[model samples]
Target: MKKQHSRPNILVVNDDGITAPGIKNLIEAVKELGNVVVVAPDGPQSGMGHAITIGKPMRFNKVDLYEGVEMYKCSGTPVDCVKLAVNKIFKGKKPDLCVSGINHGLNNSINVIYSGTMSAAVEGAIEGIPSIGFSLDDYAEEADFSHCLKYVKSIAQQVLDNGLPQATLLNVNFPKGNGIKGIKICRQANAKWAEEFDERQDPYGRPYYWLTGVFQNNDKGEDTDVWALDHGYVSVVPVQFDLTAHHAIPLLNSWTFND
Candidate 1:
């Protein structure tokens, strides 16, 4: 049997409210690995990337959902839940690992920038904690996660034993249902959205618009997350917070600013 502190203390979070089945499944998987805590949004917060509730007061309440796990529901963005967990809830205690998601949909390729699931994991990395985000390609409320729990536990166990690199975390995505064959460490694919807006009218006849898009992937690389998912493998991409274009710095230095 592993001793108390010998096993990691884990903080679990997600964008899809505390009540979502995705988080519930995640909580069960992590419990077998270590002590777990959950702090998540009170309602669905999809697409709220890295957003904090600075403009308004944030609130959270404890709930008894998962047995043997301490859980809280917060009225803030996914990032805010991490902030609250580290700063207020845990205070001086820092968790060994932070895991987000088992999100209802895919967060691969360019979707990371707009993903609240990834944002929660990003927040943990910002606070100097080892973090990881997990998502499934399925978007339905009843999406099957039976195939993901084994991989989730294995990956979480490995991260707990061997910590992640500084300033970097993992972005993991799984294909929906029981089709997953194995895990693949992959790079982020070059992809973007072919956007469209659906115009519609309300009961009052005022027009409103709903944003939609199809993904366009130009890169044909087989070592990318996109390719891995398409091949029925779970994709794990190591992500960094620094967005500096190191290659472009030299080009800017050659420009003459003196007029």
Candidate 2:
């Protein structure tokens, strides 16, 4: 018997399409948690970042994939999907929390800048809802997320139970396979991608370049997300939307541009 007076309605989403195995597994895992409503893209939108459809018309339709779960597929970016859900779809009802992704690849280090997974969660944060983004460091379509579900549910429940700081959300990454030991709450690591372009000739004889890179982690701190991930644990990074360099404000006031 399920006890339910209102178990906190949870709005689940992801950058991956509705049918992705990652989300399929996620929905099953969260069924015991609360009312799960999924609003996601109709297809993969991996590197879409935080983009939204403004100049173009967006479309969303109810989906029948998950039997008792409310699911919808949108024709816009991940951010657009959240906007539609909050403004139009679930208008009068507010979700207790929003969780994005069991993404195909890692969103650690600097990859969050280009992650559609994090963007959806960030959009929820912007709307004053507690949110979280979860990703695994594997890119295969059938990647094993067996090692991630327990940690995902634990983190989600923690966020739901304790709540989060206003204007902040979590960006979580799990190591691939079953070797993961546990979870670690850490800060974002200072790292970047060292790019390399591979030039190739297209079928029409036109030259193009494929962008590739080696991830360079310059931070050696044990408390960083990168360090935690490398140590075989799920890294929970508290992410905030405030990009202001507050410490630099005082230094900027002392600058002399007239000289």
Candidate 3:
């Protein structure tokens, strides 16, 4: 751990490229809270879950997109941006905080498995940093983020003041519009995507496919993130990177081995 500074060093990252409106709003929400440094993908990289660039040279360039902000565009995945920020920019000193997204679309429930926004936050947790990922329900480029800024600042301030539990970060999702009820601490909903691939032929008669899917939420519990978002409350779920199924481990231990 590095020496604590009077003003915390905050690292901001996202999957929606470096120029998206979501990131700008996120920067705005936290700019006054700390010294912010942004490192994000050069273009939209949504659904890129915890992906990293390997066996290829990745590009990193500093650009002055936001006035008075230190921003860099990376030609790699969102996870790569975090790695680069920690390795090259911070020089092995982890930031006081790491926040990902203000994503244009929701990353609740099963969507977190495929979200680059959440993955970036997960990467921060893996590095032993207190991190959080933020997302809005709307997917439009011009989605209004005014309602989210206040909650963003409040939650971020809380995280900064009181560090998160071990091996955990937050996955926060907000409902669209100005009628937010409140924030709720919730669990990830039981949900998944029912997928279909539309096949078509190219000009040369070669086959191609377009992935499409409908999000299906089977969990009906009111204590879930899905329920919170549906009812106009911002959902904050504590997320951890450990994939081990501890419950199953005990059952497996009880099985007889006759090999």
Give Cα-based local distance difference scores for all models. 0.92, 0.88, 0.94
Q: Over the stretch 160-222, how does candidate 3's per-residue lDDT look in tens digits?
A: 888899999999999999999999999999999999999999999999999999999989999
Return the clash pairs for model 1, or none.
none
Q: How well is each residue in 1-259 modelled by candidate 2, as lDDT tens digits?
A: 1223469788888898888887887777676788888999999988899999989898799989868989999999999988888987779577888988889899997888889999999999999888999998989998988888888888888887878988999999998788788889999999999999999999999999999999999899999999999899899999988889999999999988976
C-alpha lDDT (0 to 100) for residue 176 of candidate 1? 80
Clashing residue pairs in all predictions, respectively, total: 0, 0, 0
TM-score, candidate 1, is: 0.96
Model 2, residue 124: displacement in angstroms? 0.7
Query: With candidate 1 superimposed using the best TM-score fit, by how many Å does residue 259's alpha carbon deviate from the native?
Result: 7.0
Error of 2 at 44 (Å): 1.0
Top of the candidates by lDDT: 3
Whole-model lDDT for model 3 versus the true structure? 0.94
- The lDDT, on a scale of 0 to 1, for candidate 1 is 0.92
Poorest stretch of ten by lDDT in candidate 1:
1-10
**Which candidate's TM-score is highest?**
3
